[model samples]
Target: MKLSHIKLYPLAIPLIEPIKMSGETITHANTLLVYLKTNTGKEAWGETSAAPLMTGETLGGLLQNAKYLGEHLRGLDITELNSISMVLGKILYGNTSVKSCFEMAIIDLFAQAQDTSVWQILRDLSKNKTQTKPIPLPLLRMLGGSLDKEVADAALYRAQGYRHWKIKVGSLPLAEDLERVSILCDLLAGDIVSADANGAFNLDQAVIFCTAEKTRQLSFVEQAIAAKSTIDDFSLLKSKSHLPIALDESIHDVNEIKYFDQANALDGASLKLIKTGGLVSGLAAALELQRRNLKINLACKVAETSLSAAATASLGFAIDSIPWGFSMSNQYLEFDICAKPLHAENGHLNIEQLNPIGIGVTPEINLVTQAHSKEYSTVLC
Candidate 1:
C-alpha cells in the first residue's frame, strides 16, 4: 500500500495528577497523534509524547517535525517498510519521538494489512528467540505526592499484586528523601523499590546516597547523576555504590548500550519508544541488551495515552524474557482517548489481550472530533 495522507493531531490531555520529577512537573500530556491513510482507504494510528526533560523534544518541535515528516513520507510505499525508516532517519536528526510516532502508524497499518498484530509481525521479523505465548509482566507503580500519600498509594497497589515501585527522588532534601525511602522499603519489605533521581544528583551525592545503608533495600538506582555527566563519572559511581545502576536519561541511541556495557557503568537500561525512535529500533535495542545479559526496564513516557501504551504492550510481549517494567500509562491518565482501553489487571499487563490485529485498539471517535474542533488537527499530503 502507498501512503495517501498523514494527519497530525496535537493534544494536551490532562494527567490524573501532576508528576513531579527532579527538574520538571507534568500536569498535562503534550503529545502528537498521527493518523496514516493508505490509498486503499486503510487507516492506522500512532502517538508521540513530548518530554523536554527526557527526550529533549518540546511540543512545538514535535508538531513541526511531525508535519515535516508527513510531507516527506507522502507517496512512500508501505510495503517497503525498511525504506520508509531509512528515509525518515535521513530527513532530520534528534526528533526521536516524532520518528517513532510515524513508524508506529506504519507498522500498525502493515499489521492490519497482514491481518496480524504488531507483536506477531515484529517477532516474525526478529532473529532473536522469543516466547510463543504472551508472558505476564510485572508492573512498576510510581510513588506520588507526600510520604503519607505515597504510603496510602503503595498500600492500595500492594494489595493489587504490584511488586515493583519507583519513587522520584533528587527533588527533595537528602534527609527527607532518605526517610521516605526507608519508610517505603519497610512497608514493601519483600517487594522491589527503586529510586529514580532523574539525573538530579551529582557523582558525589549519588555515591553517598547510593552507598547509604538505608538505600540498601533498593532493587536498583536509576539515573542518579545528571544526563550530561561523563561515562567515567557513572563508572566511578558504579564502582563505589552497591546498588545496581539502570540508565534512563543517559541512554538514547542504541550505541550507548555498547559504551555502557564496556565501561561496566550500568547493570540495566530503560527502553522507551520515545527515546529509541520506534518499536523496531526499541526492540532491536532490547535484544542487544538481552544478548549482553543486561536487565531491561521496559517503560513508557510519563504522561502517555493508551495508543502508545498499547504499542508498548505488544513490543514487551515479543521479547524473549519479559522485563521487570510497566507499560501502565493508561492507568495514570485521567481517561484514555481510545475506543478500547488498554488497562492493566491486578498490577500485571496480560500480553494476550494485546494480540488483536494492528496495535490492538482504535481511537475514540469523540476524541478525534474534539481535536478537530479545537483546531489541533492538521492534514499534510
Candidate 2:
C-alpha cells in the first residue's frame, strides 16, 4: 500500500512520583507519538522519548528528522522500510530515535495490513532457527539510584513481587556504590539484581567496581564505560571482573555488533528498539548476539509512555532469546495516559490478543492538559 500521510503528537506524561537516578530526580516524561496512514486505510502508531544526556539527540531534533522522513516517505510503498532506512541513514548522520519511531510505525502498518500481531510475524521469522520455546515476559523493576531513598524504593519493589531489579550505579564513588549494593543485596536477598553505570566508569574503575564484593550481588553490569571508547578497555575489564557484562551504548546498530563480538567485549547486550532503529534491526542484533551465545536485554529510556511500552512488550515476546527491561511497570507509578494500563502481575507481563493493532495504544488527549512541558528534550538517541 502507498503511504499517505504522517502525523506527530508531542505529549508529556507526569511520573506518579519523582524517580531518582544517578543524582538526578525526574518528575515527568516527554514522548513523541508518530502516526502513519496508508492509502489502504490502514494506520499504525509508534512512540519515542528524547534523552539528550545519553544519546545526544533532543525532541526538536527528533521532530525535524521526523518531518524530513515524513516528506521522503510520502507516496512511497510501505513495504520498503529497509530500503527507506538505508536511504535515510545515508542522508542523516545519526538519529536512531527518529528512525526507530518511523520504523515501528512501518511495522505497525505492515502488521495491520497482514491482519496479524507483530509477535506472530517474529515467530514465523524465527521458527526454523532455534529450538528454544518462547519464554514468558517479565516485569522489570528499576532500582533508581544508590541513595537511601533508592534502598527504600528497592525494598518496596521486592515487597510487590518483583523478581528482577535493574540498579543504577557508577555515578557514586566506588566505596559508596559498593555500600549501596551491599545494603540492597541484604534487603532483597533472593531477588535478581543488575547494575547499570550509564557509561560512567572507565576500564580500571569498572574492574575495581565489578571485582568488589558488592558487585558479586549483581547478575550483570551494564555500560560501565562510554560506547565510543574502545572495546579493548571493556575486554580488559571483563577479563578481570570475571562477571557477566552487558553493553548498552556500545552496540548502536546491527552492523556494530560484530565489533563487540570480535573484541569479546561483553557477556550480553542491551537492545533498545530505538537504539537499533526498530523491531527488524533490533531482532537482527539479538539474533547475532544469540549466534555468539550472548544474552539480550530489551531496555528502554525513562521518557517512554504506554504506547512505547506496548511496542516494547511486543518485541520482548517476539525474541524469547533474552530477558527484557519493560520498566513501564515501575515508571508508570502515576496514572497512565493510555486507555489500557500496562501493569505487571506477579512480576510478569502478558501481551494482549490483537485488538487495536500496532502499538495497541490510544492516548487520552484530555489528560495532555495535565502534563508538564517545562523540561526540554535531551539528545539520547
Candidate 3:
C-alpha cells in the first residue's frame, strides 16, 4: 500500500496536577498527534510532546516538520519503513521529536497492516529473535510539594502498591533534600528510593550530594550533574559515590552509550521514545544498554495521552531488562484522549490492555471529532 493521506492534530490537554521537575512546573499536555492513512484504507496514529528544555523541540516546530514530512511522504510505499526512516533522517537534522512523530506513525501503520502489535514487531526484530511475552511493569512515582505533602503523596502511592519512588533534588538545599528523603525512607521502609537532580547540581555538588548521609540511602542517583556535564565529571562522581549514577538527559544517541562504556561512567540510562525518535530507535538503545549491563528505565512524556502510554506499555511488556521502572504520566492527565485509557494497578500495568492492534489503544472518536478545529488533513496526490 502507498501513502494516501495525513492528518495532524495539535492537542493541549490540562493536567490533573502540575508536574514539578528540573526547577519548573508543567501543567498541560503539549502534544501533536498524527494520523497516517494508506491507499488501502489502513490507518494508524502517532504522537509527540514538546520538550523544549530537554530535546529542543516545540509544538510549533513539530507541527511544521510533520506537515513537511507529509508532503514528502505522498505516494511513498508504506511497507518500506527503513526507506521512509532513512529519508526522514535526510529531511531534517536534530528535530528528533518531530522525526519521532512520523516514525511512530509509519510503524503504527505497518503493524496495523500486519495485524499485530508494535511490541510483536520489535520482539521479532530483537537480537534474541524470539517470540516475546508480556510482563508486569513496576512503576515509579515522583515525589513533590512540601515535605508533609510529599509524605502524604508517598503514603497514598504506597497504598496503591507503588514501591519505587523518585524524589527531585537540586531544587532545594542539600540538607533539606536529605532530610526529606530520610523521612520518606523511614516512612516506607524496604521500598526503593531514587534521587533525581534533573541536572541541577555541579560536579562537586553531585559528589557531595551523593556522599551525604541520607543521599547514600537512595537506590540510585539520576543526573546529579547537569546534562552538559562531561563524561569525565560523571566518571569522577561514579568513582566517588556508592550509589549507581544514572544519566537521563545526558543520553541522546547510541554513540553516547559507547562513551559511557569506555569511561565506565554511568550505571543506568533512561530511554524515552520521544527522545530517541521512536520505539525502533529507543529499543535499539535499550538493548545495547542491556548488553553493557547498565540499568534501563522506560519513561513516557509528561501529560501524554493514552496513545503514547499504550505504546510505552507495549515496549515495557517486551523488554524485561528495564528494572529501573517506568515514569508513566497518565495519572497526570485530566481526561485521556483514548477510547480505553491505560491505568496502573497496584504499581503494575495490565498487559492485556496493550495487546490491541498497532500501538494498542485507539483514539476516542468523539474527542477526535471535537478537536477537528485543531486538525489539519490532506489527501496526498
Candidate 4:
C-alpha cells in the first residue's frame, strides 16, 4: 500500500493514579498518537509516550519528527518497511521514539493490507530457532506508592491471579525500600517477584541493594544503577548481585545488548518500541538477545494506551521467551482511545481475541483527539 498522508495527535493522558519513581512522579502520560492513511484508503494507528529520561525524546520532538518523516515518507511503499526504516535512520540521527511511532503505524497498515493480524505477521517472521512451546505468561505488575498502597494492591492483584510482581524502588531509604520489598515478598510468597530501581542508585548502592538479604527472593533486579553506567559498572553490579539483574535504560542499540551479553553483565534486557524505534528493530533486538540466550522483557512506557499495549503484547507470540514478562502500561490509564481496548484478565492479555486484524485496535478519532482533559493540550492534527 502506498503511504498517502500522516497526522500526529498529542494528548496528556492522565493515569488512574500517580506512580512515583526515583526522581520524578508520573501523573499523566504525555502520549503522541500517529494516524496513517494509505492511498488505498486504509487507516492504522501507532502510539508513543514521551520518555525523555529513558528514550531521550520529548513529546514535542516526537511531534516534529512525525511531521518531517510523514512529509519525507509520503508516496513510498509502506510495505517496504526495511526501506522506510533505512530512510528514517539515514535522514535522522536520533528521535527513535517518533520513528517508532511511524514504523509501528506502517506495520499496522501493512498487516491490514495483507488482511491479517499483526501477531500472525510478527509470529511468522520469527525464526524457527526462536520459537517456543506454549507457556504461561508471568504478566508483570508494579507495586508503587506508599507501603499501605503497595500492600493493599499486592493483596488485591494476588486475588486477581497476578503471580509476577516488580517492587518499584530507590526513592526511599534503602532500609525502608527493603522493608517494603520484604513485606511484599512475604505477602506474595510463592509468586515470581522482582525489584526495579529505574537507574536511580549508584554503583555502591546497587551492590548493597542487590546483595541484601531481603532482595534474595527476587527473580531479578532491573536498572538498579544510573543510565550513564559503563560495561564495567554493570559487570561489577552483576558480580555483587545475588539474583539475576536486567538492564532497561542502558539499552538503546545492539551494541549495548552485545556488550552486556558478551561481558555477562545482565541476565535480561528490557525491549520497548520507543527504544528499538519500531517492531522491525524490536524483533531484530529480540532475535539478538535470544541468540545470546538472554531474557527478553518487552514493555511499554508507563501509562500508554491500549494500542501500544496490544502492539507490545502481540510481540510475545514471536519471541523466543519472555521470562521477565510483559509490562503493557495501558493498564495504568484511566481512559483508552481504542473503541475495543485490550485489558488483562486474571493476569493474562488474550491478544488473539483482540486483534482479529491489524494491531488489534480501531481508535475513535474523537477520543483520540480528546485524550487530554485540557482541550489546549490536545493537538487537532
- Candidate 1's C-alpha runs over 4 A off are 128-131, 370-381
Of the pair 2 and 3, which is ahead by lDDT? 3
Candidate 3 Cα lDDT to native: 0.79
What shift in Å separates residue 378 of candidate 3 from its native position after superposition? 11
Please rank every candidate by lDDT, starting with the best.
1, 4, 3, 2
**Top-down TM-score ranking:** 1, 4, 3, 2
Every candidate's CA RMSD: 1.7, 3.6, 2.3, 2.1
**lDDT (tens digit, per residue) of candidate 1 on 1-381:** 888978887877778899889899988778788988999999989999888988888777888889988888888775665665687888767688999999999998889888998888777767645546767777789997989999999999899988988999999988788889988999998887899999999888899889988888999999999879988998999999889899999887679999998998998888899999999888888888888988888888887778898888777777746555864666787667876677757778787666488988788858755533243556564
Worst 10 residues of 1 by lDDT: 370-379
> Which wins on lDDT, candidate 1 or candidate 3?
1
lDDT (Cα, tens digit) per residue for candidate 4, span 199-241 = 9999998998899888787888999998788879989899889
Candidate 3, 281-336: lDDT as tens digits: 78778888988889888888786778888777667776755688888877777888
Judged by whole-model lDDT over C-alpha atoms, candidate 1 comes out at 0.83
Off by over 4 Å in 4: 129-136, 373-381
Which candidate, 1 or 4, would have the higher TM-score against the true structure? 1
Which digits, one per residue and each the tens of the lDDT, describe model 2 over residues 1-381?
Answer: 677877776656777666665535666676677777788788777777777766666677677787777777778774553465675576566788888887777777776777776665665565534445446577678776336877788778667777788877876687888887878877777666788888888778888888888778787888888776876787787788856888887787767778777787788888777688777777778778878888777776775766677677676777664553555532553665666666666676666522445555656655543442444331212
lDDT agreement with native, every candidate: 0.83, 0.70, 0.79, 0.81
Clashes of 2: 9
